[model samples]
Target: MSFVHFSVLKDECLQFLTENAPSNSYFADLTFGGGGHSFAIMDLDESYKLVGVDQDPDALKNGAKLIAEKQLGERVELLSSNFSKFPKLIKEKDPEIEFQGILMDLGVSSHQFDIPERGFSFKYDAPLDMRMNYEDDTIETAADICNTRDADELEEIFKTYGEERFARRIAEKIVEERPIASTKDLENIIFHCYPRNMRFGKIHPATRCFQALRIAVNEELGVLTEVLPQLVELLKTGGRLVVISFHSLEDRIVKRAFKELGGKDSPFRILTKKPVTPSKNEIAANSRSRSAKLRVIERI
Candidate 1:
């Protein structure tokens, strides 16, 4: 398809970022998957400077096209690195350039899912390679995890990340059918593990299991736990932090982090008590956004 992909919760995220962002402020697009949100923020204020981060090689290539297309090279900085490392880079780029807005559209992008080679979707049969950073050798692929991790660890991953009710049974079946090498391989395994009647439920029986594997292989939640607070601290005083999470686990982490960062004694004031979700139209257009929750907090 096209390199064009929409960002989830775009309106709410841009509004939160713009409302509190100071004139001539610096902004960081942490999950700069397709640069949709970054371009939106740049549209708001020409004076605002943006630093976009993404480890995905394809996203960086797309970022170049976006920046050039918008003639934003003068106002934008692109970093081909994990967003978790941005704090150090900011300190280096401008020891004094404290950012006024930080937007993290967490989880895999539509671009990732649409690319079958990346193996993020159950719809396609592809290699179980789900690394956002294809260059990172440290990350274990989904197939590797499926074939290698012990039954208990697999169960724990499914429980912690996927929250699957049949985590134990799934793990047992996965171990029983070792050497699973592709999305179809794992999906078929999950299919056989659950009863035939229950397989055709509301959602695919393999959805949660695949999600758990993807999260585990990518170390997604672990990175989020470390990244969110640093994103908060990286913001200038009165700066805004807008995050769009794709699942309950991520939303819970964002919700808890924002609440802890701001109270009577903390350094932030919550802009949104509850998360902002996509509109009906947006959800209809992009099914990936149905679970998105946007939450914002401002540093005090």
Candidate 2:
């Protein structure tokens, strides 16, 4: 069966990774969403070994099939774990292997958002589950956050992660209407929280709330911040690290991390001073690709 995926920025990512490869050096695709970048880079060069990491078990399962089908068994290694744990795992896998190219395409996959049962999309009437790993039984969920978190705490989540200006009012309304049990119910609460006149903005009113919940449910930003410096350290000198972020909050994290690592006195040099967005052609083909911002830096 064909994997349910259309890789974003295929040509662009391939160009950056391949061009920066250290004379056929090893590479790591940290997010490895669809194995598109891993497959492309592995296929482009014979000496390029690959490690593909993902938190979701199902994604790695699909990746296994994709790797075998592509006849990349000799070149690629798949890991079923969070990329935040990547440094320790990399050393565990093979002490001799050091990555020359690392790519992190952050944010939820198309598969996650498209499948209603996963409860990623607010427009879809799915269950409230948003766990990246079905096996990870710990951590608070969107439902728990909505129902259990105080109004002040919930408001801060919306403001920080979602950049929602009406965050405080939304949290107040959510507190009044407790136990938001479904995606639609949560969306409705956010929709009505805003006055009718103010609600009809360019994007849906619930957009930020959903994003905030997903980040919290997954602890995405925290994981990212923890791992950023580690990834820079793991890179070989002159090695390239590419990060693609889909939202402004994510972009900000990536931007700050890249800047700190790329400092002249630091271990790396900046490659993309400004983040790169998708071309008009790519954006036209995939609407979700529009918001993506790609940034790269090289270990000095």
Candidate 3:
């Protein structure tokens, strides 16, 4: 399948990032999944340049192709590092470099969930490999965690990352059914772990556990927390840092970090007192965007 990702809140993000922008400024899209947001920034103005970064090899490859096809090779520079390492990587390239606007659209990209072999969704019966950077052998796959971790540890991961109510039961059942090598295997275990009556709810029983495992496998929350302050520091004065988080945990972290960074004595100010959610029309058009929440902060 082609790399297709519907850029969530494109208008809102662009408004916050580019409105009243400085001349000849640079913008960074830290999670350049499909180059949707990155290319949008460049198309908005010829004077604006973009630095697109992503860890996923597939995304990086697709971004390069898109950049070339759009004749934006000169205006857009695509990097292959994870967003967490973006600060250090960009610093090494040019110590004085700072961005006019920086954006982070957190959570798994639509392409990741759609690819069966990538193992991001319960809908697929593929291997339980949930590493965002599939090339990074150092990161443990979801199968490894399911097959190895103790029930208690697994429970903690599901409970803390997924907010799963049946985490304990599911974790215990997973230990009983060790060697869960595939997504369907893990999904079945989680399904049976739930009460029979509750299994047919609107949301699948395996949703939370799958989400938890993906977050755990990728260390999404920790990376986000670690990178927020660095991104703030990399912002130019009057520049903005905009983030769109899909889950509550991610939103909480972004909210807290923005508050701390935008404190009275700080060199930043919170732009969105409350998060901005998608419009009714937007959610109707793209169901995946329903849960997204956007927040922005500007360096003073």
Q: Number of the top candidate by lDDT?
A: 3
TM-scores, one per candidate: 0.96, 0.94, 0.99
lDDT of 1: 0.87
lDDT of 3: 0.93
- Residue-level lDDT of model 1, residues 165-256, one tens digit each, is 88999899889988888889888888888888898999999999888888898788888888788778788888898888889998988889
Model 2 spans with C-alpha error above 4 angstroms: 20-24
Supply candidate 3's per-residue lDDT for 170: 93
Better candidate by TM-score, 1 or 3: 3
Put down candidate 2 lDDT per residue, 1-300, tens digits, no spaces: 335667777787777767756666888998887887788887787878988999877788899998888888988989888998999888886776667888999988888787787788887997677787856778666887899989999999999888889999999988999878888988888999888997888999888889888998999999999998888777787788888888888888888987777776877888898888899999898888998899888877
TM-score of 3: 0.99
| TM-score of structure candidate 2 | 0.94
Query: Candidate 1, residue 90: CA error in Å?
Result: 1.5
Report the error of model 2 at residue 180, Å.
Answer: 1.9
